[model samples]
Target chain A: MTPYDYRDLDPLIHSRIRLSILAILTSVEDAEFTYLRDQIKTTDGNLGAHLRKLEEAGYVRVSKSFVGRRPVTRYRTTEMGRGAFRDYVGRLEWILHSRPMDADQREAG
Target chain B: MSEANARQQAGDDLAVIRRLMEDARETVSNNGWHLVLWGSVLAVAEVFDYWAESGTLPVSPRVVWSTALGLGWGISIPLRRWSRKHAAVDSLANRILAAIWIGCGLGLMLLGFCGARTGTLPGPVTPGVMAIVIGTAFFASSSLCDRALFRMLAISWWALGSTMLIWPHPANNLVMSAGMVLFMAGPGFLLTRRAGKPARMELVA
Candidate 1:
């Protein structure tokens, strides 16, 4: 594979907003809608749009319920999402570490 | 973007993701007040039971334990209701923690009932078994939360539990009381204190 092949990254996941959502969701069991919006520092409209994209991709599952009579929404990553994220991270790491050693640094030894 | 620039951005993105994951993990709080409340109640009961057995009180030692258990249930029911009302999200970590404590509580209750029926459990043996159960719960929770403090507490419980098994009478009861304070109530309070603070960002090396 070509070194640092940015084109190879998953279009759905490579976007900054989606990546942030996946990153947060994968870390916990689940999180509320307000919590995600607050942490990602995005408008409700923007986050809802991105979350919809991720949900359509089957990377996230959203459930709605009531908490003390108020509607509550929570999000969690699916098994498929977790696997895809792991692969994405692995590819990124491989790209970063596979860079050839600098000639100057080699010569310094 | 050029290969060099692509690599740079990739590394930066990875770092940001790592930081976010760490923060999210930290936010998965386990309500520790339950542990603290139960531990305090049980410790008091144990001490009072010991005192009553020593002829310091005119009442039966059973009265102290029954009263303590009744008070514990009364207080815990309201505390649990309040927490549930305030909680907006029911996360997986919380569920796992709840399951662990619930299983432990059920097991203890079963053990007590069976022992009472069969007359197999001695007073000194009860504390040792309890310590082992508490230690197991702490160990599991520590691994799940990635916290070293709970692991250390688990070890403490195991060691203290073994000692309690070997000792008898007032000494065993005292050790059990001390164990509740140090391992359960102490960590519970620590969790409460830490809850108010913002999670620190951890970056990948």
Candidate 2:
């Protein structure tokens, strides 16, 4: 088998923004929508768009409720999503660890 | 609207949201953190009492680690997030309580390994008693952190430890260990499964 396979990997989470979203959700038991929004410093529309893509991929679960008068939303990672993230990170590590020797090393030899 | 006004409005909204989220998170459990803080103290003390009674641990090194697994499953795992929000103990109390428990464990372990007394027990009973006293103080001062159920396995540490203090027995440790595995760790295992589930409103309360 190949050392690394980026193929069939999640493009949605590949983006820096979505990656952070997954990272944060996976760390905590659960977090609120505004917490993610504030941390990511993204507009409501942008976050909503990214969340929709993740939700569609079944990587995140989102729920909404009302706290007294205000609407509330929360997000958390799925088991599959968590596993995929770990695998992605492992692949990244393998790539770095398995880099080919540079021209300088060849010349030195 | 002017940029200044927009900024002001956004700042106000941020403040409001932060408070709301904080409150929502807090509702995960009641003042249980205080109880947990006390519970840790109680755990350390219970360890000491075991030393005092046995002049040594009833179980071997492997058993001690296994018991810890059951205790954490029984007490620590289920209540961790609940403890995080309860804020029942002030920062001073938490650090002190945690320190006392950790110190008690390490101290006894050291005394035992060093063969300081060549006895069944390790460490001075005084330290363990002091830990219990401090823990009781914290427990008494704080209101119940959460519902009895919300506490899950942590309650057993308090109950079983106190029981051992009153009436010493090897059987009691069995009870304590059982309580930890059945009550504390069991729920935490279930919660871990849930943690991976998509965050939803129904789970918030």
Candidate 3:
């Protein structure tokens, strides 16, 4: 397969946990940190680190607030994040459908 | 990875994404108690009003309606608070559903109490308008959550409301009451039964 076929696949969203986070956020307006933690089935530290990475990349926006005495943190996908996810999925679909015959033909030549 | 393995991995990733999205959407549609509570309250009030108007009950219609509204609000507020506090996920769909129902309730209240007292809206037409408002809410909810049952409920409410509007009669109270039972309470009960308990998750330490 040519490098062009899969080159556009987003490296940041290709991981399982980050991909799952984006998928969940895409389905809802926002989600609590604990909800993401439970859904991803990952350790708090692991989820936090990945979230920080996504936040730094401007893919996720975080909001912190107090519910009574407890502090609550919520996350939402940024517009860029949504766009990236859509593009990532699109690339995956294209790669899955495209055959590697061009590379084979080049080898035969 | 081999081409076949890459394809299989891509397919698996898509499947996981689909499952998570479905799970998130499902959370917004699990609220059933709100419907059952309001339906029961309204049904009881309608029946009591019917009996009183027919001279079978000794209570005043005003007293019955007042108590019914009072009880419905009294329970609904706390229940809403509790649910909000306990919810694991709060989606836009949930917020939209709440807004729709709350708006419908307030609109009905203003029409029923203020409109009736001001001699603008006749008492006989109040129920029909209320049903139409409720049906509109059900329709919004059906569209939001993609529930066919809610669509059916919307149609049922519209049909009942139209009947009451077209044919003004004392027995319309009974018909409205039955609509509450069949469309509102029955669906609420079914939703409650169909709602699955939240799956227990094993957290990583």
Candidate 1 chain B, run of 10 with poorest lDDT: B196-205
- The candidate that wins on lDDT is 3
Instruction: Report the lDDT tens digits of candidate 3 across residue range A7-85.
Output: 4468898788898899889989888998888877888899999899899999999998888898999999999999999
What TM-score should be assigned to candidate 3?
A: 0.77
- Candidate with the greatest DockQ versus the true structure: 3
- Can you tell me the CAPRI class of model 3? acceptable
Per prediction, fnat is 0.51, 0.00, 0.51
Per-residue lDDT value at B92 in model 1: 71
Q: Give the poorly placed runs of model 1, Cα more than 4 Å off.
A: A1-3, A41-46, A56-58, A78-80, A97-109, B73-89, B116-119, B201-205
Better of 1 and 2 by DockQ: 1
Candidate 3 displacement at residue B122 in angstroms: 3.9
- Write the residue-wise lDDT of candidate 3 on B146-204 in tens digits: 47888988998999899899987888888889888898888887777765555333233
lDDT of 3 at A67: 80
Model 2 chain B — which ten-residue stretch has the worst lDDT? B196-205
lDDT of 2 by residue, B30-142 (tens): 33343433345334544644554575756554355445535644664456544544221123333444454445445544544444346444233323233344334334333
Give the Å error, residue B41, model 2.
16
**How much does each candidate deviate from the true structure in C-alpha RMSD?**
5.3, 16.5, 4.4
Instruction: Compose the digit string of candidate 2's lDDT tens values, residues A4-92.
Output: 33442456666656766666566555767776766556778888888888888888998777655777787777897788667655544
